[model samples]
Target chain A: MGRIYKKPVSMTKIAMRYCPGCGHSIAHRLIAEVIDELDIRERAVGIAPVGCSVFLDEYMDCDMIQVPHGRGCASATGMKRVRPDLIVFSYQGDGDLAAIGTAETIHAATRSENFTVIFINNAIYGMTGGQQAPTTMPGQKTTTNPYGREVKVHGYPIKVCEMLSALDGPIYLERVAVNNVPNVLKAKRAIKKAFQIQLDGLGFTLVEILSPCPTGWGVIPKKACEYVDEKMSKYYPLGVYKDLTKKK
Target chain B: MKNMEKYKMGEKVLMKGNEALAEGAVRAGCRFFAGYPITPQNEIPEYLSWRIFEVGGTFIQSESEIAAINMIFGVAACGVRGMTSSSGCGISLKQEGISYIASAELPFFYANIIRGGPGLGNIAPAQSDYFQATRGGGHGDYRVIVLAPNSVTEMGNFPKLAYDLADKYRNPCMVLADGLLGQMMEPMEFNFDWVDPDKLPPKDYIVTGCKGRPRRIINTLHMIPSILEKHNWHLYEKYQRIEENEVRFEGCNLEDAEIVIVAYGTSARISTEAVIKGRKKGIKVGLFRPITLWPFPKKAINELADRVKKLLVVEMNMGQMVEDVEIAVSGKSAIHFLGRPGGSLPTGDEVLDKVEEILSKPASPERERGK
Candidate 1:
């Protein structure tokens, strides 16, 4: 008999459509498990962004609003303000959360809006055929940056966690990876903690997860997971950039 | 909060169109207002800041028009009435959110106090946005209820009508006023019973708050091609129903008129004056004003073409609505157009001169037969 070890009650029976070894399914499962564990499924209002993950409503069993690209934070801020009783969070990818939506993410964090932001940084644009992303590492090749990213030309990678840490409003900021078993467990903890802080009526919270995109990275699934561990983590370190609770 | 009546019902007050429109939203129980400052429409959020606060609501002069519209989306999703306003440039920024709101079927109101523009044109009165409003302003095949208010009283009242229609259809409605109507001072009455948002039926579809309910999803994406196509067809059915039911227009002196002028908003106001002057000069000229510019009162225009020999369209832009008029009349009447773009407004006498010029041409047999 197959014994169930751990699962999420809020995840739907529908099959996931993510690519092979894509970390999005893992991130979604982690968030779903966290929401189920916290018993906030009934009150959770999720804002889905405009990328490959735009279909979060298909998997997440909670109330979900699929928003346009780069508008996740603003949409969540609006719903959270009117229905503060509900737990509102926006799930966004690197391009949606960083480049086009930079203003929304910054303003929402600076306002300390009482909500949660789950940012998935795969270092490349996966949905749009592996274009160079704002989070794409230097000396790396992408569709837009075929010659490997030059620092002077593309500018340095956007350290979103560090940039957000400088802002006064955000109460929690952490960066985690989901490359291996131990890291996957740690990523779950960070995601759960971000949601918990939102439940406690804390200020804005963000958890940057270094997701793997084997297709975008032009590698096999195993190589993609290994690349996230060896290469991605170096540029985006695994730690808490800011925690107001620790300060207090 | 102090115990005082914030507004006097049935009280006549001198107010600008933008101020009255803002207060009108307050009376409509629009509990949330988020907007960015743009020329010709700044008074809207400035008045709503205090007025919405007095009503125990929220007002945020957001960082950009981008943030402003999405903020409105946030509150609207939570089942409260939310709104935003701007002129040309700010409105262009709001189109993305408008497409989202329409696709989600979120009922809300937004006002565009029209200004001269292809891009950051100027803070002057113009109806250049007619095509944008009548046609869907953003991507996808969708339609929004567009109300063109001519007078300050209409400016004060159209927001309530817009919101009512918005809730009735679960669609977005816009009050398309211009800088001239928004900035000019006039006496307007404050009235209309404010409906409580709590009592509204959208609670059935609102995202979660009071626990243990089925999760509601407000979305626009239907990835499966057939399913998405079906969704578009459903939206189209609703739009067709709206077109049949919501066409509104005002006709002045249609009987025994040889020439008819078509216009709306400020141009209609000037055309009304022109019709009076044309009548005094024994020129058989009249005015046809389309209030709902999208549904367009096409039937009236089509029917009038059977009688009127000549038709002229006047606007603050360069020949936008003429296309719609051409479709309606179908060459049944000889058509003429006069417009002043780049923020130029044609006065009543100037429009009268155009009507006189049109009347100077003797009606050919084909023109008289409306061929």
Candidate 2:
């Protein structure tokens, strides 16, 4: 009998440096698997952001560039515009995507740049020792907000998929979680569909994976998965925000 | 010369400095341009908006100066000639990405049509960004080749030089001009034929795809302290070579000069006029203009300081490059400064008068400061 499971050829043999229970490794695997399944590993280029995923080049066995904080989409836009035949995607974390890179994120979508964005929204700043993030839930405790996030002072969490869905430029937008086996499979499918849309020469496509950061969240790996399903999923619902391919 | 015929575009055409420089970049194989609109340099993006499409290149009026510079960083990483342009505060915004590109060792090109500034200063011709441009202009210990173009013709021709040097060194190169040069109209001719970027030799480091080879990664993060230190040392050595081999300057009547005026960009143009007027009045004034700001023409200035009695460093700022001149002179000659900061331009008469006053004075020990 054939092997039941195997690593994707697009993934490097190097062990990821992510903390235990950090969803970055899984998210990276999903992207690598998607690239392999599409058979576009030879022409795929990834742009890594400045947060925890800055070392993304070590995990993805494809042409990749690590861009400055929040400038991944801008760099990816440059790569795509110059070489339209090549597949390009930018992998960014919550702070790297929603906070500092808000303008880059919004404008790239506004222009409908032909590229893919694999946004990992773990709702906290992982690399910087659990600092308050742009998507931090109200009352969520963090290193910066030692007394818990106050809505009046800290403001509301940004809903990236919902905010971006309002724009007409992007051809696809989806938010999926990686809490359970089924949800992980669904995330892989969404990631693959985003890449397929890019392959078909569609406009901007983004997949926001509600990842887990157990260490940042001050929880165990098992508890973090439960927290994602019970709390994070309720706030950031798991569904397609927009899909140009679907008819009204 | 036989080579001249290859690049000769026949007759000179009248063109604004910003538009001509934009055309020059396209002719020099810059296929990607991303810039934001700012005073004194807006024509650069405006021209390239339609012009880039004509050559089947990419033009993006990027969301911000940060995005624009990063876009060039992206294209340059792909081993393609790409550029961006902005002025003053806009350039301040681009420094973050510039540092990253320099650290990654990507060949990049850009231009700065400097306007008055500290914060949203008026859009007038100024060279206040001298220290910012020459001192790496960013957080890291990196250097960018800064070419100061004084005239419209030089503005039109310098992009080719900037791109060639950037590619040769795999570093950032910038054409540093001021609002005067960017807006002024002059008859200029192209120095080279339109280059086809496709014909350029393929670079092995570009990120096109892995295909049959091992994948390539372009990055600047060296988490390990020792590894990062080694990388910094590598950049330092490259800069050392650049300083040794790439120092460039243009001097006139230095053989028998009593006073030499050290200047660049708009100040250089004004000082050139002062030199001519001083010569007519038998003042024996010569002009020394630096073309490359970083890797500044220091050794030559040090040598020239020995022969001249006094060196007058003129600028459109509150004496920025004058500091470099002093370092190079190192007490060899009496130094004087004439500056007009904040949207002000020094007239030829004012500079000539300053030169005459310095010559008349009895070599004071302190060497007069800024006027």
Candidate 3:
């Protein structure tokens, strides 16, 4: 008999509670694989925010703290201060991170808090059944905007990675997508690098992954991935937003 | 009798209220101090920065009040004694962090040296933060143990007491003072035993979690509304326990008194002198000084109500603590309120006149005659 492939050690045997074909599971698996590869499972502390990834604490086989909605950055800041030895990371969705928690995230980065932030930007609020998010592209239709998002009324989408990269405190900032296998591989690398930056005691490092929300986008799972490639990628261009490693 | 160590309690010294509070925190085993400098309370952080460095402790000047408070939250989450001091406007910025600390059940200390106003209140001392401190300032339903210190000595001692109380109850505690107490220079003595954070029992419930034991979790999440209701009830029950166990008050010449004056913090100091003046003028008056404002000394006042005919509640704010006194007296005595707001401190003469006026009223003429 041939050897069987095993699931990532960082992933628990507990079944994920995410909806079928949701990209959150993929992102979770990628992060878990990185954790297992880096051998940081025992020392890793995950901060899970409210939204679809609220149960990221359960899925990831590591110690976790569930922060209040829009407070993941503050909670993670606290955790990082206490346990500077441990690798702390905050997993936040677009609405939770970019909208309500904007100040916390921006300031934490500006203060150069040594932690990793895994920002999953799906462009819409998924957990609350498809509401408009800060990163939702113009003309994108959400439950709250049945007439499509109006630029005059709602303002343009926030480019968090680009905006944060301009700040001096962040040691690493990158935006990656997880719609395809190639992008998935790149995202894993970016996630691993973000953790490694924290391990090096470097300042804040965030990897904003443009993920797909099949259920929230009102499209088939395959079409959701295609939609991210054709539509979302144009609005939020991929590639490294900032990297301090190559500076000196 | 000759060979003994004298108990050094209540010895006066010349020290700023903020400096005394910093000294008190250090003596109380506060190893972590993170704060941003704000008016009327900047001396606290400045003193801690110098003193904490001398004692081989962490002293971080955070980016802002928001960051400073969050840092304290982090240190407290690690089960270390941590504290932060700020004035009115800065404290407003810390509400979110305070709410998180409460939910996480982290015991920490905070010092609020109040200043004037509804906006960027003046740097001058005021008791405007009464509502924010006593009541829940944040969104959620929560309570913090608030200790109002009147003198520099009390300011120095309350930090230690606040730390002990916070640890014992597993809740955040506040040492509430105003500009007078924050900036004044007075004598203070440290008598409380030092707490060695290293020798303390291990905090298994801390976020550090069980390294070699079962996975431990500290959280305030209750998905079910029923569970949340139960949790809130449990918190209230703990508050009730605190109210029963930790009510502190000082009764000065309450026996055979014609009138009782209720006051706290700096106001209490003035009220004491006023009571003395009233006594010299043949008015039999006493002062009730509340040390712990939250777990108020209700039973003590209730007991004193039978002895006194009239009650006057004197405060720096516009009749805030008067409400508490009324609740305690329960209509047994006529409670007269005297207050000076907007950075103004009430003088001894002002309080004396208020007490005399309440005593000489036609309703209490018998009490006035006895005086």
Please give the distance, in angstroms, between residue B31's alpha carbon in candidate 3 and its true position after superposition.
Answer: 3.5
Q: List fnat, each candidate.
A: 0.66, 0.82, 0.20
**Which sequence of candidate numbers ranks them by TM-score, best first?**
2, 1, 3
| Residue pair clashes in candidate 3 | B12-B187, B13-B186, B13-B187, B150-B265
lDDT of 1 by residue, B1-371 (tens): 35324557677889999998988887777888888888899899999988888877888777788888898887778878899999988888999899888888888999999999988899999999988888879889888999999988888888888888888777889999999999999988866666555666655777874266766788888878999899889889989988999888999999989999999999999999999988998888889999998778888999999999799889888888888988898888888888888788999999998888778887543322110
Evaluated with lDDT, which candidate comes out highest?
2
Candidate with more favorable, higher TM-score: 2 or 3: 2
By lDDT, the better pick of 1 and 2 is 2
lDDT of 3 by residue, A1-248 (tens): 99555679777788987776788988899888888888888788787788989888777777667766767776677667656887888899999889988877898898888999999999999999999999989999999998899999999999999999889999899999999999999999999999998988987999999999999999988999999899999999999998997773
Cα lDDT of model 1 by residue, A17-100, tens digit: 989999999999999999988999888989898888998888898888888899899888888777788899899999999999
Candidate 2: regions farther than 4 A off:
B1-10
The predicted structure with the larger DockQ, 2 or 3, is 2
lDDT of 3 by residue, B16-134 (tens): 88988888887777777877788889899888887876655777776667767766766776677888989988889888778877877789999999988669868788877877887
Backbone clashes for every candidate come to 1, 0, 4
lDDT by residue (tens digit), candidate 2, A130-231: 999999998889999988889999999999999999998999999998888999999999999999999999889999999999999999999999999998
Candidate number achieving the greatest TM-score relative to the actual structure: 2
Cα shift from native, residue B187, model 2 (Å): 1.0
lDDT of each: 0.87, 0.91, 0.82
